[model samples]
Target chain A: MASDRTASQPESSRGYAPASGPESERGAGPRAGSVQCTSRAAPAIGAPGHQAGAGPALHDLDQATIVARAQNGDVSAFEWLLSAHEGGVFRLALRMLGDRAEAEDIVQETFIAARRSLPDLAAPQSFIPWLYRVATNKCFNLLRSRRRHPAHPDAFDDGSVPAGSHDAFAWGEADPRHQGDTCGGLCQDPALRYEAEAQMRALTGLLQAVPAGPRACWLLRDVHEFSYTEIATIVHLPESTVRGRIARARRILAEGMQSWR
Target chain B: MAMNGGKPRLGCGRLIDDVWASIDQPATIHERSCRDCQSARAALDHLEAVTRSMRERDRGDAAQRPSSRVREAIMAVARAEVRRSRRVPLATTPLGTIDISEQALNDLIRFAASTLPGVRARRCTVLRSPTPQSSPGGPSSAGVVDGGDVRITLTVALSSQVRIPATMTLLRERVGTIVQAQTAITMQQIDIGVEDLYDA
Candidate 1:
């Protein structure tokens, strides 16, 4: 009778990573200045703004079903939902806040808020956009509070991850064509690559100089590939305003880096 | 700011913004060589690099995710939401009552079960049959382990090459022996769930 025990299964519930921290581990990242894509930094999610191309497909994980089940008060279902979206939420918060602990707090708060607000959420299909809305609000609120009691001496600190420690694209996740194609023929010299990386690192602060509205739009477009409609939904601006912000953000980024380029 | 606003278009005559919108493909070969276009391209690359680097760091750094303390907090909430008993009676003596945490007992079972040859357990849970009064919000029971009977359910990752029936039989016996000898708890039922077969 004991030879073949029925296989016991796990609950498949997803757990939250901590937000409160000594915040020391993340202190090693692209602080105010340096940044790179070590094996640790690159997620298999492909590029944020770059359209997913011929790389490995990320379509296998179906989140819609998870969301539906979570709405029914299913704990395991909620775990599946958390597992699917937490990475993006954390990343967006980290970029906008520029402080790992604050980002962690935002992420934890986002999930908690999501848990509280799920009953009113009507559209499961629009969960990602809706999640973005909740997280963006939290980020904006934090930014506003920071303004009332500022900590830093300058806008961009440049005290991030040290240079040359981590590889920018170590895992070959970059489209072969991205590094090897048109741009490479012109800018592939070892020195040019080094300088370009340095200039990019330095440009981190300037990104903060971008007006908040356009910065949000730019990040939504460039960092997350959110469309005009998705962006308008989150920012509560008209579609026209969304388009303008994206354009303005691009222009500002290009202008800010004019000296570096 | 107007430095590139009036500059000549790239060899293809497309504005730098247009080229950047379709970064992978430039209408003209000018994308690689034009002064204004290169700046815009570098800006796009810089953003991409930031996203990439941050992601890698988050995945690499254990701190990026919720710490174990956070995990417990969430689990605590989950425990409240679900109606699962959290404690198991280990013994009863003049020193109040001795009990083992449901999670602690599971961990004990997991360590024992996975110690066998070709048997690696993932979620080893020592479950108790819920009584009529008990509402199962969580899995396993607080008083069930000391009740001297448990329904142990675990997902085992087995070596595909092993003799399934024989290996599992020996594993059940070995793990059961370990649980009884060390914890002195009776094995009500040891259920082995084969979650996946691994080549290694």
Candidate 2:
């Protein structure tokens, strides 16, 4: 679907008119904390901060306050909550679905469903994980539907198989020459960044071969850095099962990614 | 070397699970001295590196914000949901009854309340007054009456310096006047609660 084609456009530049009133002042861009790359050895993708686009009055309020207000049926507070988490939700969906439009649909559905059930969410602190659960279930449904109907046959058809083995380079985008280049801090180099992105695209394509359950577990654990316990709650699986699935997924991807070493 | 369910067995005859476990936790004594386990761990480390790199680049490249059309559609649905769920009875005549969206009424009340120098609206609920024949103790539901008086419960955060009595009276008067002037619905009661205090 050429999902990455819009990669460079800042979200605010897109024509979405922010809701009128105080929320309009909230920037519609990615929260700064979400995008910072951490140490690779033990990367911990922190919970998203709610500081972006906050007006002076709301600036001091914590996420719990915003959630509590939303629970009290404050639409503006809900909108702020939406704005804060939409980016993370969208990225999760995109990685899960690999289609831009479908991912966007999941984001819309997730928040709408969330609004309907927000009153029932007892703990304001559990909002993020609850939100992720909502999003993950939607993705699972879509994936199940796709498996039944085969809507996009070419979505996972990377056609990268070489000779007898599934070489990493055979996966369309990444080149063999860049195999060992970690591109860790060199992401600032545009050429390296582009290569890294291409490799990521290839990795996403490879993920299609993993079963949906393990795929989700792997993404939540390895990519998003959710704790195993948190992932179990989000995916509705036992903690042991979640760990097993993640290990199985790693084994599968490692075999396919052998050439990268 | 042998295979366990198509997975390569380590030279120590351990299954792939051992390699994964060693990488996930601190290496056991045998793993620290085992060449096969070390080799497997090195390969897994490279895979982890690749996954981490993918995550970093994916975050960098993925669209950080949803497109405008999607945002508008989602918010439109949200606003509609709020209006649908919380409509308040405005009037009822022989011809028909008129209702006002609770969201709209809340917006009006909030705006009116904010005009006061030291108050900020936190939450507002408009409840329909029970018809006179109903049980006096019966609960009054929102948007239930064909045409009748409405009760408003507004919660606000007040600035520390505002005179409590005067601010409360002024807030009540302003809110009552605005609802009456705009919607022509008589206010049976205006309950204002100070839920928080903030500096002016």
Assess chain B of each prediction and give its TM-score: 0.56, 0.58
CAPRI tier of model 2: incorrect
User: For residue A177, what is the lDDT in candidate 1?
Assistant: 34
- In terms of lDDT, the poorest run of 10 residues in model 1 chain A is A34-43
- B68-111: candidate 2 lDDT, tens digit per residue: 78768878988777766556667678988678776677767776
Compute the interface RMSD for each candidate structure.
Answer: 21.0, 14.3
Q: What digit string (tens of lDDT, one per residue) describes model 1 on residues B140-196?
A: 334455456566665454554676666666666766677677666677666665544
lDDT of candidate 1 over A1-261, digit per residue (tens): 001112111112121112121111111111111111111111112111211121112222123323533453445545545655566677677667777777777767887678667757865446677888898888888777766675732222112212221212111123333442222113557775565445545555666665555667666666565666777898887876666566555555544544443
At residue A234, give the lDDT of candidate 1: 87
Candidate 2, TM-score vs. the true structure?
0.63
Q: What is the TM-score of each candidate against the true structure?
A: 0.47, 0.63
Q: After superposition, how far is residue A65 of candidate 1 from its true place, in Å?
A: 1.4
- The 0-to-1 C-alpha lDDT of every candidate, in the order given, reads 0.51, 0.62
